[model samples]
Each structure stands twice: as C-alpha cells, then as structure tokens.
Target chain A: MSLALSLAPLAYVACPECDLLLNPVVPEPGDKAYCPRCGYLLQRPRKRSIERTLALSLTGLILIVPANLLPMVGIKIFGNSQDGNLWTGVSALFKEDMWAVAVLVLLSSVLLPLVNLGLAFLIGFHLFMHKANNQLARWMHWYEHLNEWAMLEVYALGIIVACVKLAGMAELRFGLGLFAFIGLLIVNAMLSNELDCYFFWQRIAQLTKK
Target chain B: MLKKPLKTAFMQGFIRCHDCGSLLKSDPKCLCPVCGHHVSARKPNSVQYTLALIISALCLYIPANIFPIMSVTQLGVAETHTIVGGIVALIQSDMVPIALLVLIASILVPLMKLLGLSLLLLCVHYRWQVNARLFTRLYRVIAFVGRWSMLDIFMISILVALVDLRGVAQVIAGPAATAFAGVVVLTMLAAKSFDPRLIWDHQLSYE
Candidate 1:
C-alpha cells in the first residue's frame, strides 16, 4: 500500500483472465501465474510481439495516406453528385454550423490517427535500429496518452448515422476510400496486437543494461 | 496381489496434517488452516490499466462529436447529424430514456471514465503521495465500467444493418464512427500502458 521508489525495470507479471500485471516472478515454460484479485493469467509475453507490431504499424502507415486522400464514399442526388473524403465531411459540418461536431470528427478521425501513426513510426524506428532515445520514450508516453481520443467505433457509428440520413434522400455509393478506411480500422487493431509497450520497453531496458 | 495392495496403501497413505503439515493425524481437519498459503491472486496491471482506459476514452470523446454521426437522405439530397443530432432525434421521437442512454453511453460515460482514469493514473504515475488505497479502489470501480462506451456504437451498427431501404433507405457508416472506435481502443491501450507498480515504487523505496 505504500509507494515504492525503486525504479527497477518492470516485468511481465500480469493476470491472464483480466490482463492485469502481477509481481515479477521467474517462471518455467508452461508454468502459470494467476491474479488472485482479478483471476487473470500472468506470464512473459510472446517473443515476437515487437516485430509483429512493427510490421502492422508500417502497413497501417502505408494505407492511411490513401485512406485519407481517396473519397471514402460518394453520393449522387437529384442530378447533383458529390464526392466526400474524411476532411470534407467535417468541413461540411462546419459549413452547416455543426462546428463542435466537426472539430470532434477531425480530432478523433484525423488527429488521433496521425498521432498514433507518428508514435508507431518513431517507436518502431528506434526499436528497430537498436537505439534508445528519451525523446522517443516521451513520444511513446504521448502516443499512449493521446490514444484514447481515437475512437474508431464511435466513428463507425457516425458513419452509420450518416448513411441512414443520406439514404433518405441521396443515391449513396460506397467508394474505394470507404473500403480502404475499413481496412485501416482492421489493420490498426492488428498493429495494436503486434505491439506491446511494456514488452518493448522491457527489451529496451535489457539492451541499455548491456 | 499382496504387492499391489502395498503400493495402493502407500499411494493413499496420509502422513502429516494436510493443512499445517504438522504430524500424521488420524481424522481431523484435512485442509491447511495454519500457514494459509493459498495461492495469492490479484490484477496484473491494475494501476496501469486504469491509465490506459482513461486516455483512450478521452480521445474517443473528441471524434464522437467532430464529424456528423449520421447522414440522412431525403429525395436524393443528403444531410448529416453529429452526435448531438442523434440525441436530438431520440428526444424528438419521444424516447427520452433511450436518448439519455445514448448520450451517456456515446458521450458522458466514456468521458467520465477517461477523466477518472487520468486522475487515477496521475496519482499512480506520481507515486501516490496521498490517499493511495482510496484512489486505487476508485480506479478499480471506474475500470470495471469502461466497456459500456460500446453501447452507442452497437446501437448505430445494428441500426445500420437492420434498417436498410435499398435505394430509398440505405444506411452507411460515417467518418466519425471510425474515429470513435479508435478512441475506445486507444483508451484501452493507454490504460494497459500504465505501470501500477509505480505507485508502490515509492513505498518500497522508503523501506
């Protein structure tokens, strides 16, 4: 219950069921640890978490450029056709006096993704080159810090809402951009799986020690 | 046959007290009541988790508003609604509870949870100089309820899937949905990134 001051390198002691961390322990292969509090399994992470994460992050960065530039969806209505991209949607909201909503849209969809990608690139680049940078560490902290604002599911909900309303009047078409956007979502999730900040930092600690 | 009986007896033989490992007991308490060293259990990333949860929640909060949450089409012309519009439509339809629930699940809950997580993380990250137990307990409560943020997203997805009017009433997802989903996920990650032991680090240092 007291605050401990020793900044020892953290370990991978986590509850399996709930994914909470446990105290550091040395375990034999196949030995299991459980959190009495949350009943989660605790153990060292898979060795490949970083490489897999880096690969996914790279892929995400590549796809994001096109996802933003391409029209996500198009609508044709009453002899007037319109093409929409991510930024235009929010701008249109501003034009319609929905400035608050437009700002939210831009932050979550645009800013958050950009931040996440930027963090991944920096972290991945540093880790790959076998260098340790405190600035990179801070960026990792910030990346984790701002990650909460990137709400893909809520964005998905917004898409549904838009589709529902647009359907009532316009001829909507699902554009390649939209498909790519969906692809971005899935790939983002994949990248998260591949990267574990704890594991990455733990490895950094080991290398720095050397 | 004799050898078999001997092996079986050895296998089933009771030595000391099972509970305390005292001495061979004939028939009393079979369980260990002495040392009480039953396996200890607890959350692995209890403190760090709350941090991640809160951070992601904050990010989701922004996009949950910025873009039009839903777009409506009338006679080939399209209009869009932000998160507020969805709430307004619910209010207009006389579904106050549902509207309120949407507002909470879609907006308020995620925000509150994120904010709560940030406070908790700040304490833990800063080494819990004050009220460590009280704050940690509060964090547990907040982390427990973080998933409800998904309700609004689910509502939108189900509505999109179920209410299709083809050319007349087709429903599509909006940019905000992706952003919102990202917030939920990112906050969860942030919560995961926290090192709860940071709190106890100070305590152990004093010792």
Candidate 2:
C-alpha cells in the first residue's frame, strides 16, 4: 500500500462514485474507462468532439431565434385564431400579474439557454482558432457550470406535455417554432453528451503551451 | 487502528479532480492544475448545506403539491389542478402513459429524492455502519433522477405558451409551478452540496 502511494500522482485516479483508488489504463479511441467498483464512467474521449459539438452548438443557436420569435402554438377557439410564441408566453404571465413566474419562465426557457449556447459557440470558435488564452479557459469553466442550469430538454418535454393536454380542450395547431424548439433541444442534448471537457481542456493546454 | 488499512487516494494524500479526473497532491487551498477547478478534500460544509437545502425543499414540497400547478380555461369555465389532480385528470382522460410520466417525474421523484437524501444525511451523521454501498448507490440515484423532476415545470411553460385563445380557451401557470420549480431546483442543489466522501469518512472511523 505504501509502495503504491509512493508512485507518481498521475498514475492513480480515484473513483468519484465509490472513492476506490485504481490505476486505469488509458483506453484507445472508442473505448472507455469505468470505475471498477461502481461502474461510473471515469473517462472516455470521443473522436472529433470539438467539431461535432461546435456544429451542434451552432445549430442549437440558430434554432433559438425561431423558437422564441415564431409562434410556437396556434389556438383556434370559436372561429377566432391566436398564435403565441415563447416571448408572448412571458408577456401573458406578466399580464396575469405573475411576475415571479414570468421571470422564472423567461430565465429557464430563454435567457439561460441562449447564454449557454452563446458561450459554447464562443469557446468552440476560440479553440478552433487556436486562441488558447486564460480568458478562454475561464469561459470554458463557466460553460461547465452553465450547462447544468440550461434546462432546454426539460422545457421541451414540458412543451410536449402541455401540447398534449391542450389538444383535448382547444383546436391546437402546431407552429414552425415548435419544430425548431424541438430541434434545438435535440441538438443541445447531442452537444452536451458529445463534448468532453477534459479532452478540450487538454487540447487547450497543449495549444497554450505551444 | 488495528484493522487493515484501505488503499485510497485520500489516504495517499491525493485528491481526484471531479471535473477532469486528474489526480493531484492534496492541498485545500489549491486548484486542479489540469482543469483549474478548486480541489478540496471534500466539499466544505457539505452536510450542513445539504441539510439546509433539503429542509427548505421539504417546506416547499407541501405548497408544491397542494396548490394548482396550472389552470385551464375553456368557454368561460376555468379548472385548476394540483399535482396529483393533474395526474388524475390525465388518467381520467385515458392518457395513462403521460399520467404516469407526470406522476413519476413531478411527484414521486421529488418525494423519493428528499427521502433518499435525508436518509443519506442521517446515515452519514449517525455514522451508521450498515450497508455503506447501498447508501452510496442511493446517493447516486438521487443525484441523477432529481433533475428530471423539472419536467412538470417545463410542461407548464409549454402549456402556457401554446394554449392562448383569449376568450375561448387559455392556460395560465399557477403559484404551484413556481413552488414546484423551487422544490426541483433546491433538491438538485442539495444533491450537489452533499459530499459522498462523508459516507466513506465513517468507514475509517469504524476501523
């Protein structure tokens, strides 16, 4: 045990799940290293992660404008038609004197996601340009923190549920923005799952060193 | 200290960076050289923060469940439904899968997360020597499944956006939507604040 501890720090990695210290072999491309005791994925570097994430991020960012600007749902009641988009939803909540709810909706549904996607694009762009400065590294760290709070997928699921419930009561017509929002959600999910921060950071480190 | 020593990175004066998987020499004041994230032996005040967050979530859970999550209006008639009421309404309408989804995502998951987190906190506090593995697994499950509770909140947002006929039919988000969102967010914070290392801390004590 003492001999193992005496080895170089780089030789060991602790399992985040079980806290079991194990020396893991660096897996070749397409392979993964898992926590021996608890099966938690320790490390798995994806091929072309940055490029793929950048493409997905750009797609998500493009969809956000349509998702918020264009009408998400069209409601026809008693031969009168009204189309509501994401921004109108916030205004409606405000009109009802639910300012707190309005703010929450605006933040979770719109602002947070926009900021996250924007940051992702900036980071991807900077890294692609080989501008590995401390500022970009700091932005990468901020991006990690922002990733958890940007709940676009959750919001998408909620929209689906709301659509289903509303279908029974009113003549619900799907709008173009709805599809764009769904596409945004899918692209964001793909971006998140594929982007490996470790590899990205490692690449940044190498570039900065150069 | 008669029992055999367990081989751990902590015991070896090293801590693993949570974000980058880099092993670094333990230094409370230092950041991980690889990822530039703050490295700590364990999350500072993890239990206290988690306990406080969980208590606040528990306080919010009542209102989240009791009040209507959202209201639907059609033809000059308005109907409000609480969390359970919403699920029951869906079930009544024969939308069993969606009903189950709402039930599990909004109601059951949050309640279970609170209970699970509280149990883990208790286990760590009392230094319970039984089933450490099970407790660790419970923590993992709570951490993972807690985020999905936001599904109901998301659904409410969508409903409010899509259903707007002015006079014929409209959907307005209720007070419960905010409270429910609070519960979900708080529980997620609670899970984040909790240090699973505390569970292992007791193992050394037992030795």
Best by TM-score: 2
Which portions of model 2 show Cα errors greater than 4 Å? A1-9, A208-210, B1-6, B18-21, B34-37, B165-168, B204-207
Q: Write the per-residue lDDT of candidate 2 for residues B1-207, one digit (tens) a residue.
A: 012223667878988776655678888888876558798777788999999999999999999888988888878799998999999999999999999999999989999999999999998899888566667778889988876887887677666766666765778888988788889889999999998878877774322
lDDT of each: 0.56, 0.78
Query: Which pairs clash in model 2?
Result: A158-B154, A158-B155
Model 1 Cα shift for residue A28 (angstroms):
9.0
Interface RMSD, per-candidate values to 1 decimal: 16.7, 5.2
Q: What tens-digit string does per-residue lDDT give for candidate 1 at A1-210?
A: 011122253322332222222345433333444444432333434445656667777877888888889876666755656677676756655555545545666777777887797788778877777776655545665676566566655566557555654554567887787877888899887776556554555545444454
CAPRI verdict on model 2? Answer: acceptable
TM-score per model for chain B alone?
0.64, 0.91
Model 2 chain B weakest 10-residue run by lDDT: B1-10
Model 2 global lDDT (CA atoms, 0 to 1): 0.78
Top candidate (lDDT):
2
